[model samples]
Target: MKIQGKTALVTGASRGIGRAIALELAQQGIRRLLLVARNRQRLAEVAAEIERQGVLVVTLVLDLTQIVGVNIAIARAWRSYGPIDLLVNCAGVAHQAPFLESKLQNLQEEIATNLMGMYTMTRLIGRRMAARREGTIVNVSSLMGKVAAPTMASYSATKFGIVGFTQALRGELAPQNIRVMALLPSLTDTDMARGLQLFRWVLPMTPQQVAKVLVAKLEKNSSEILVGWQSHLAIWCQRFFPSLLEKVLRIVAPLSLSRSKSFGEIANRQQATGNRKGFWRIVLDFGFFRSNIQTFDKGFDQGLKDKFPD
Candidate 1:
């Protein structure tokens, strides 16, 4: 699990958490780094940055949704870097539409990108790792993977699948000396959240912050690490008090919908204005507000713990 001088492959490495993770690994002395994403330019940019740190970086612009392309990309990476010591499956997408209104294509894409892509990449590199009897796999999952939410049914399903996949794979691969870890992050500030307004109230940490925790946990070979306090509480609540949690969610559903509507409107207005600055300003505001909610939720949990003193 040691990162220093290791060869690491990070999918979705063009930006956000993937980019941060790639950089983190490089900083940890992971010399042979493979950065994968659909955008060649961005991938090259990341590669340049990593190379500045004196690490050897390979950029692959391959759409992971394509099964054949993914297999080819894995083969190319292996040829270039030999057996990958660490594989970080970070590529993902989210669709926010009501269940009844959701399109089949959108659902298919989510499953293909979020679930199947990870499966494909893991299987390819995992086999190599097992043969070598050394490696680590980190799947960047979400808190929604552990609990469901309105309008995010499809997204949540994919995340839930990831959770299950990682857990089962961990059990299967332990004997092979290949550690499978799931890094569950709450909402995070990234382009993926750009079109979603309701997420503004969820206030997520920056990708860099989440990446720091991810890398730290990987070093310790932790099986799963929940990112935020609210995330931990959400998992515990769903597990220990499902009835109470359901009632609370039902009461808050209307407010959540209203927030989503408002956010969508704001995003549309910003788009109409064609003001990039204004668009990002709104995003920043939303991120901050969401972070506040996460803080409050965590504080509430702390208060409960103080009262119970278990």
Candidate 2:
């Protein structure tokens, strides 16, 4: 878990937390850094910064969803830069909209980038780590993964999926001496988060702050990491005071999205979209009252966790 002399591969490294983590790893004396993202220019800029810090940096411009391309690039990188000692699955995307009005394309994109994207990278790198019998994997999931948010149903679902994936891997890969973990950072001030209306009572942390916490937690060998006092407090409420937290979420949720529409109009709109199923079932799938019911005793919760939205 030590950063010094480690070879780390960070996805979504073009901007946001991934970018910050790459820089932080360099500052921490990481021997080799592999930065992955779709933006060639941005990835190159990040690699340049790390190179200035005297870290051997490599950048890969490939989409995570493209499995074959990712496999090829990662294989080449491992051959050229040596094995990756740390794998950070920080690549993700978010689409915010009311479930009823949400586009199918948006949800598909979210799944492709957030969930399956993590799956693809983790699977490929995980095999290598297991064979080597030593490595650390940090999956950057979000606070939204712990609590469902209004108008963010699709995004929340993907984040929740990430938590589940990380947990399963944690147990399955433990025998190989590979440490799989999750880092839950609450509302971070980033390009993707800036577009959404801020939730009440939420103090957004900067990407650098989250990155710093990641490194600190890595040293402790924490299977799961939460950033800042805000994340700790939020998860505390979620575990001991479920009802209170749910009520707070309802009050802060951005339900004012379609304020111009009446109830009858909304019902009619749903009917038009061929939503003739039972109301409660649709509500369940839509994430209404969809809370993660679990005991998060001292950051050991497995119920939920998002990737870097850079």
Candidate 3:
């Protein structure tokens, strides 16, 4: 769909990928934007920036985990902006713990925020889009959604659910002329990654880069766009060599376990005083997987160049 003059609602717009998407949309001349997130102050800051760009901006303080709040926010956006021309479901959370030690609550929270919340929001907005017969929905998924990773079972499960959900929604919405697209970005440099203590790998794309790719792909109504070469490799490996992939993951599992143990120590120390600070301390000390990022970035850039080859 053409973004110019369109109205868009973007969840998790306070920072990271969502923030980048909002800015990109604004740059495209999408004159009206509804920014949704739980932090009112941050949401206001984002709105201010977008408004400064000379576009209409609406900010909604919403905890997507609360179904009622999401519904209310959708209603408010509809009342304010009329029918939403685009809906970007970007709010999500991740928690990493050993399968045996992970609590039921943690898993449930992941499912609720990442899976069910998207389901709820999509159902509400999708019905309106169908009725209008003109809209676009972009669901931000992850590489983990395609491959199961050690200590990220819960995250992987939620992402996998997104892939299925987006694909199914795409098929269902095809007849209505409303496009449903899934943008599967691999490790990205974002606050969510910092919160999850996942700084060991090189993130192939910055949030801005991912946003650029997403906007370009959305223009074409692509069903799914995987953002990085590593992601493409993971999908291919899973398809052609599942057993070898499992063996390789087993070999690399120990390094992941060691990192998790270190994070667990920090968690324990902080828990004693109810302060969960210094969780990212290890990333600075051990120089995060910068080489991996360079490698992935080079591959991604080369692939893009080859495909576009201007």
Better of 2 and 3 by TM-score: 2
Residue 237 accuracy (lDDT) in model 3: 69
lDDT of 3 by residue, 181-221 (tens): 88889877677675554434333367898899988887785
Q: When superposed on Cα atoms, how far off is each prediction in RMSD?
A: 5.8, 12.2, 8.4
TM-score of each: 0.82, 0.82, 0.81
The number of clashing residue pairs in model 2 is 4
Model 1, TM vs. native = 0.82
* Candidate 1 lDDT by residue in tens digits, 1-310: 6788788899999998999999988887786998899999899999999999999988888898788988987887798678789899999998877678779999999999999999999999999899999899999889888878767889999999999999999999999999999888987767886555454334456788888898878868589889988788877877766654554454333234435444445556767978666445654655544544565466557656655668
lDDT of each: 0.81, 0.80, 0.78
- Residue-level lDDT tens digits of model 2 in 151-242: 78999898888889999999999999999999889888677776675454455677999998898788886877888887788788788666
Name the regions of candidate 2 deviating beyond 4 angstroms. 258-310
Model 1: runs farther than 4 Å from truth? 199-201, 250-310
Q: Which ten residues in a row have the lowest lDDT in candidate 1?
A: 249-258
